[model samples]
Target: MNKRVGNQTVRLESKPRIISTATIVGPKEGEGPLRDYFDTILQDDLNGEDSYEKAEKSLLYSVITAAIKKANLKEQDINYLFSGDLLNQIISSNYAARDVDIPFIGLYGACSTMAESLGLASMIVDGGFANHAVASTSSHFSSAERQFRAPLEMGSQRPPCAQWTVTGSGAAVVGTEGNFPYVTYVTNGKVKDYGIKDANNMGAAMAPAAVDTIKQHFMDTGRTPDDYDLIATGDLGKIGRKITAELIKDYGYNMDNIYIDCGEEIYDAEKQGVNAGGSGCGCSAVVACGYIYKNLLSGNIKKALLISTGALMSPTASYQGESIPGIAHAVAIEFGGDKNE
Candidate 1:
């Protein structure tokens, strides 16, 4: 259900396009240091049985509120909300969205929630089912840790390639096609695994998925890396980025000049304890909303490809000796036409 047009690839199933995106931090704009607030929320008292759910809710609220503020629209005007998180039954997103007036459609794509949301939202807008729609996703460290591994105070050491879950949220609004930023292309990835046992090395586990999507994007569009001003991946840590580069080179594409990974872009490796980079649903969302949007608005970069990658294996699946499955989806965003350039 996908086709290519000129140098762009479009998904017939995912039409319309994203108009505006906003990402926000939970603990207010000037609320002390970013890392400090995240740590406090994780360690502080929260009135939920599940720490992860609490954190997730907080982040989701921050993102949705930010999206509303940035888009300059009232909550009631939004007809539908397509959202997802890592928690069971999407408790965090559901609880956070309850106060909003829009209808809700919960989704699950592990780390690929953003792509799923954008895809569905675009379809709704393109099909004339709705004019304005919002898609969002979130994740937190404390909640993800407790649910997937050990308690917060377990004091376990992460592997070299381990990625810290980003404690934030991201949301975007998609409207009917116009002069706004449009989703020029999209490509879905099949689940692929490398059979890596270490839970910490998500980069090793997810590298295959990243490569698969990047390769497929080129194949589907018949465009090389040179066509994009920047080819970005969601949360591929240092390890995964390297692997992705190798894979792209093997496929006869050199993405060295215009490649960026959200995980590596957000935090400083030396300053932060993160050995490789950041992960979780928030990583890609925040970067796209905050950094990418800003750059696009200011004309710093245009024609960017955002590929959100996810590890499809849960703790239970890993415990059962199941190989980690991963998936990724690529969405191209273009700002201004030749006139602006």
Candidate 2:
């Protein structure tokens, strides 16, 4: 049938359910305001590994395995695994997949990977192509820094607008039937670059992409900000959040009441000493899976729209003086809904 609702949105008739979720964070994130919401917290950034990169892989492995276990499903029971990370070749997710023994689909949407994987998994399960699927994403501050910037010891001067890359991983299992939160729709974003070239200022670069996707989501669904209990966007710290608000207002949608940026809410920015809060694949992943998922389960929220935005720029692109292109994917999740009702 015509699952396509609008130009970029898909209205899933099957409503794939998020059966279970697991989130793991490093020491910094564990010390943040949302510390209590996470499923697992590693006291050490290295997580008992010899290298930070390996530790990131460990985080991904822990979350994926824990999500499968929480759902009472074995690795073999999952028909597909969609995962990604902020690493060259996505080595973190690649190695994690090696340990899980599931058919894997590696994706790269920069930091928007969590929503990207979730959207794909929802479609697969809703289309009868799979009964169960796992969607996961991870990011590490040390690994990202080494990949995209300088080494930790280099003591690079971070600008006020620069965001801290979150050290964490989150995974969720999407199945045909469950009593948990259900994914009802998805909106895949388009790459948009607004001539911004500062790698540190990711929020500014990605804000427009987020606004475009959110506007498309509302237009396609014929919904407004009031329709959902919350509208959360991936990173977008303070600067990006402001820009998004202004742009959305220009589009005739007032988001002042319901909007929350995961990066801004994840930490006590002043106390944490993080210049511009957090930004990474794990930033939105952990917040959505840990904090938002629990709130939905407790009936605190009936409907939520999570827009995970990514800066699709590689070290090579940045080095070449190319402007950062941004993308965002939106997923609508609802809890405790009957199929007919």
| TM-score for each candidate, following the candidate numbering | 0.87, 0.98
Question: Per-residue alpha-carbon lDDT of model 1 for 89-188, expressed as tens digits?
Answer: 7788899889677889998777777776776777677667887889899877667877777887989887778887777778888877555666656676
Candidate 1 off by > 4 Å: 1-17, 26-52, 177-179, 338-341
lDDT scores in order? 0.73, 0.93
Runs in model 2 with CA error above 4 Å? 337-341
Per-residue accuracy of model 2 over 254-321 as CA lDDT, tens digit each: 98988999999888899998888899999999999998999889988888999999998788887788
Task: Name the 10 consecutive residues with the lowest summed lDDT in model 1.
Answer: 28-37
Indicate the TM-score of model 2: 0.98
52: Cα error in model 1, Å: 4.8
